[model samples]
Target: MSQFAENVSKRLCSLDVFRGMTMFLLIAEAAGFHEHFSTVTEGTVFSGIALQLHHHPWNGLRFWDLIQPFFMFIVGVAMPFSLRKRLAAGNQKKVTLHILRRCALLFCFGGLIALCL
Candidate 1:
């Protein structure tokens, strides 16, 4: 494999591909040009797939609902890689401090967004 491909594989694997595919299907096909895939997709697929991915009326799980979880998982996965790089570069102090700061910031941001909603 090429150096770039090898480096990326060391970072994340096919799970990232799945996330990208999910995002592409939701954004490109569902939100934008769904008509293009209508003829090619089977009856059970892509037919209101976007709508179904969203949460149910009151409460329940759904494939579309997992998108947020997948994104949060990627961020969690990134923390170790990012912290390791900082430590390797002699920034262990900064890395240690930033982890908590980032967590707090993310929590606050999420809270604010939820409040607005």
Candidate 2:
């Protein structure tokens, strides 16, 4: 293997790839790919697959609904690796502040979205 490939394999590269794929799906959905595809493919064999791109209405889960939780799972999984690297750098103060700032921003944005909804 190449040196770059060897170095990447030593880390959680698969997790990064999974995170990228998850983000790509989210971006595609945001760009209306799912809605447009579903409309165009309606009443065909592909319709069933397209249906999975939308959330189920009140009774159960759908594949689309899982994308968010899967993303969150990826973040949770990656956090420890991040913390380990930061801690190894010996800057606990900066690390703690960064974590706090991230949490605060997430909370603010989440609240704003809920309010908008």
Candidate 3:
């Protein structure tokens, strides 16, 4: 494969892995794993771990709170590589417009989902 293609592929693979890990943590929390641990092992090390897995009560941040930001960071890291690859392939205008539209759609949908939740 071409060098550009290989680099893009590697970058995308790493991004996918990061996203997958983030999603897994989210799903595990949604499944009440942390809550269960906290309830079953209160006043112990497991309780402390469970607390870290959960969000802060209010007006603060926890490790769990970093998940969304980490996902965004991973996306930001991948964006330049993706855009460069597309532009290198000679679809400059089309790729830029498509990226803009995709980002806008994601923003809107994400806001809507947040509101619904």
Clashes of each: 0, 0, 0
> Which residue runs of candidate 3 sit more than 4 Å off their true CA positions?
1-9, 12-14, 107-117
The true-versus-predicted C-alpha distance at residue 77 of model 2, in Å, is 0.5
Q: Candidate 3 — worst ten consecutive residues by lDDT sum?
A: 6-15
TM-score of each: 0.57, 0.75, 0.72
Encode model 1's per-residue lDDT on 23-67: one tens digit a residue: 785686456455554444547556666455444564667665776
RMSD of each: 4.7, 2.9, 4.0
State the displacement of the C-alpha of residue 23, model 1, in Å, after optimal TM-score superposition. Answer: 3.1
| Candidate 2: tens digits of C-alpha lDDT, residues 1-117 | 587787664469789799888988888889999999999999999998898887668557778889979988998898898899989887899999988999999999999999999
Query: For residue 52, what is the lDDT in candidate 1?
Result: 50
- Residue 101 local lDDT, model 2: 99
2 or 3, greater by lDDT: 2
Q: Could you tell me which residue pairs clash in candidate 1?
A: none
TM-score of 2: 0.75
Q: Which ten residues in a row have the lowest lDDT in candidate 1?
A: 33-42
